[model samples]
Target: MLQNTVSTRRNIGGTEFPILAAALPVVANDPVGDTYWHIRLKAATTHLSSRPGQFFQLRCPRSEAGDPFLRRPMSVYAVDTNVGEIAFLYKVTGIGTTGLSTLVPGDTLDVLGPLGVGFDINPEWDHVLVVARGVGLATMGPLARALHHNGVALTAICSYRTPEATIGLEPFELHGSVHTVYDTDGTSDIASVDSLIREEHARRSFSFAYTCGSKRIVSLLQDLSSQLGFGGEVALEQRMACGLGMCHSCVIDLRRGDTVESVRVCTRGPVFSLGDIVAPEETLSWYRSCDESAI
Candidate 1:
């Protein structure tokens, strides 16, 4: 369990008391590649209730001018409320993450969360098919662990562009059966997301399909879920500034029956039902552009 934990309420961004904190870091280090970092936060009482895929708006302590005011959003990688700790798996993309990467073990980071909607898993569903690409595995890992602890079966299909880009698989395999797919590497027999899904379906019936990765993969899973006659959810990677509803930076167009409506990713969802999203091409493009801009 985490030490020195306490809880307090505070107002942020015109919203009264949305965050709680222990305001300290328990773990911080670079993962295998420079592309990502693993951080564990010892939270105050309020951080205990977060669900998988929900995120926090993190505030980095500044040393110079021209730093951004609004906290940057990052998904909850793992939660151990008993220990008063929350884990984060984030890549160093911009000034926020770069500052975050520089922190030592004892540094304090201001956090506002557990924000955004998370994956909704049905208790009745015994088997879950998890389709992940790149860092999406971080968003799905804790849910896989929770479901596994509850006796639900987990089958993970992790896809990467190459062997070097592959991440978060070692821990995921601990919770379930893991199949790694590399597009340009010959380490695994499966090279594509579609091929891996077909392999899983050929073996057994999966009640739920959870995806968090590329928009192309999400689109594919939506079609496959309908064909397989199962419910599914997608965790979108959007460019979010506020991690709250006010900024309007993370908007997504969703289909609500015969009509389409726009929803903010930070508030309405970072996770959405497969049937809810409309054409995500523009949103996906925006994310890529923003992510590139950060780099």
Candidate 2:
């Protein structure tokens, strides 16, 4: 399978990591809580050199759900270079993820990526903040580890529909403090979350921020980034085909400073500056009525 790998270079923070398009062996695939599956794959060190916010186009195996024509774009959940492994935490939502759910140890999973841009981390920042919910937890997971590795402090505000459905606990706990909010308790409400972020920002004085999962949260953070004078990034949720930009299927209108331009989510980003996004509250997509991710 390693012999089938294809490679290309992508520059992030001035370093180039070869993009991997290979059929890697699944090392572990297991259910998480009630709704998600955590799958690990054995791959070369190069395959695991992915940064947070970057994603892969997963070729789900044929199953009862049938053969899915397009590969699913999944954000990298975790990477372990020491063990030559990479992992993804995905919900079983459609044919693609349903097939993914059937994978087991030693099975080959065709994957194309470490694709797209990743979160831009500023080395000078001493402390940072992250806000995530549901699949957003998977998107933010690797970034937390990278920040921890760099000795940067983190404060995570995690939201979930239920405690049982929550994901990405360990990385949130590493090198930082975590605040859990659940929809059942009503603490995950936008207003309450806005208040929580403001208080935390005042105390920790986070120099930068990052968020994934909810538009309301992104909207809230966008307001704060302006009011508080701290800059941040948001990892957008978009359903894409071609993971590469060739198809232009994931293109979206983006506001950058004073100019508004269309950009490709798979290329320009699944990640963007907090202030650069336009009307996140009105961003009516999972890239529309979407969020079950895995489909």
RMSD of each: 5.1, 2.7
Query: Which ten-residue region of model 1 has the weakest summed lDDT?
Result: 286-295
TM-score of candidate 2 on Cα atoms, chains taken together = 0.93
C-alpha-based local distance difference test score of model 2: 0.83
Tell me each candidate's TM-score.
0.84, 0.93
In angstroms, give how far residue 29 of model 1 lies from its true place.
3.6
Model 2 lDDT at residue 154: 94
Candidate 1 Cα misplacement greater than 4 A, ranges: 1-18, 63-66, 186-191, 281-295
What lDDT score belongs to each candidate, Candidate 1 first? 0.72, 0.83
lDDT of 1: 0.72
